[model samples]
Target: MWPDTTKVVLRQGPEVHIRPMVAADAEALHRFFLALPEEDRLFLEDDVTKPAFVQQLLAEQEAGRAFPVVAEASGEIVGYGVLYRPLFGWSTHVGRVRMAVARSFQRQGLGTAILRELVRKAQGLALDKLVAEVVEDQVGALRAFERLGFHREATLGNHVQDLSGKKRDLVLLANDVAHIWEHMEALVADFEPSAG
Candidate 1:
């Protein structure tokens, strides 16, 4: 089972609460997606702006295949840590990660905060590997993944097209659990509630 709730201090120095996605958060998640920039939305596999995709995501979460969580600052949803694991597929042992942060919050350590939580969850699930794909133009996003030990594994040129009809390469990054876990353990420890 996923952990209850935790608060993280962003790299830019603000505390925000994060917790696993629940069915009731559908509306908030939808609003969060609609608030993101067009460039960020263009590369998503699903049109989250539509109610259908959000429903599908909720269904997937209900079935235990998806484990998405939202980060909230004050009273608004600011980001999410999207994680998934296939139940019976060939890649069942692998965890897939997708991160989204509010535009104003990007590059301020929110992405890293969300990712650290996801990595800790993956480790608990005993996953063998974690993977994330970033569009070539999203240099900051790629760097955020790298900060957590994700290394480039593959790059597919012209693999996806953006809204401008321009093709973008997909940068595939992977982190082997064993090698990255030691580094992430310290972070997991930091987020734990104090024993006081």
Candidate 2:
């Protein structure tokens, strides 16, 4: 389902290459996470800076339980996104997506590009819906997901704790795969230059 690589131009002008994560990326992935600020890492489910965590992610990909996409610019990883789904279970039709973009690339469409890749993968996998969890404090992330057609399905009060030990509400956002694809097409049309 993955091509060799593809390049995407950010809304703000930088170009990034998107590709599937490989085993050789373990060290680079570790470095990418380590570069993120501690505050940015707070919402992450795992300690991504650890090499073991990177290996685990690779293992999940190898085991076919996860699909990871990497975005690179200037030979460095600038964004990462993953789609995780159960192989067998009642929830097998649903995929959970997580994404992170480097601070320098935020707000420039890198996050959206990475997400677009994951959404495409989800469609290819025949997933019916995609869900994302965000802390209440992540207003930007919430808005971004909403723009992509996700709606808040539920909010779990004090469901997650930050690295600082502060409890925060966890907002569950979800959308059907078909609806998300429709919204994405609309976004593309809105951004395309008019031929006049």
Model 2 spans > 4 angstroms off: 192-196
Q: Per-residue CA lDDT of candidate 1, range 1-196, in tens? A: 6776877766666678889887888898899999999877778766778978778878988898788889998878999887888999799889999989999878666776777778778878889899998888887778878877889999999998887779989999999877667755665465433211
> Positional deviation of 143 in candidate 1, in angstroms?
1.0
User: What local lDDT does model 2 show for residue 14?
Assistant: 76
lDDT of each: 0.81, 0.86
Candidate 1 runs further than 4 Å off: 185-196
Using all chains and alpha carbons, the TM-scores for the candidates as numbered come to 0.89, 0.94
Clashing residue pairs, candidate 2?
A: none
Instruction: List RMSD in Å for every model shown.
Output: 2.8, 2.6
Superposition-based RMSD of candidate 2 using all C-alpha atoms, in angstroms: 2.6
lDDT, candidate 2, 145-168, per-residue tens: 998889999999999988888999
Clashes in predicted model 1? 0
